[model samples]
Target: MNSAEFRAVFRYIQALLIITQASLVLTDHREMLPPSPADINWLMHEWTPTVVRETNYSHRAIIPARNSQTRAAIAKVTTCDASAALTAQFFTEVEPAVRWLRSIYVV
Candidate 1:
């Protein structure tokens, strides 16, 4: 994704958060990622920990965490860089991912 595409996706995500009636299943099935860790960081920056803390809607982000560009993403959330604690978990499979969402129960 280019910067504009990234920003568009970011805005879309932010828009999704505006609706508070349901859960969000965010599946990033992209075969590749935009060539910038800075964009990833910007995205994380845009979606703040306060949003995670405040929103009642649950989200399941099915991202390829350990072995991809999202490795940086995984590290960012896992470390909670500068208190940017995104409320997401990484999963390579669906069963455990579902279990995790159920386990959290954001509602």
Candidate 2:
């Protein structure tokens, strides 16, 4: 794929990961429980690498170094009831990443 297409896919993957993290937070909050191993497995198995491959195939956009950091943060938050501090951090980290991803989109 061409550079633009690849960038688009990279951006989509970033956005998808951000969304999945947010969804995990919301689900955990609603359920009044920490995220389970199953939840993490689903995120890793069901969502992550597929998006990465698609992104790579289309745009060859480099994955941000911070992506893993963000995922780790999400995992930490998910593993327990989120404190106000954790919630604040999650939004702080996620919003900008999402915005960065959105900026790449053509539409």
- Put down candidate 1 lDDT per residue, 1-107, tens digits, no spaces: 68778667656665667674445555544454533666666646555454455554355556564446556564564455533334566677777877777776654
Q: In candidate 2, what are the lDDT values of residues 1-107, reduced to their tens digit?
A: 34345346535656865564322121112112223445445445544445434332222112222355444534553343322212222233445545544555453
Pairs of colliding residues, candidate 1: none
Model 1 per-residue lDDT at 15: 60
The parts of candidate 1 lying over 4 Å away from their true place are 21-30, 57-62, 65-67, 82-87
RMSD of 2: 14.3
CA lDDT of each candidate? 0.57, 0.38
**Candidate 2 clash pair list:** 6-58, 6-59, 7-59
RMSD of each: 3.7, 14.3
> At residue 5, what lDDT does model 1 achieve?
82
Candidate 1, overall lDDT?
A: 0.57
lDDT of 2: 0.38
* Worst ten in a row by lDDT for model 2: 23-32
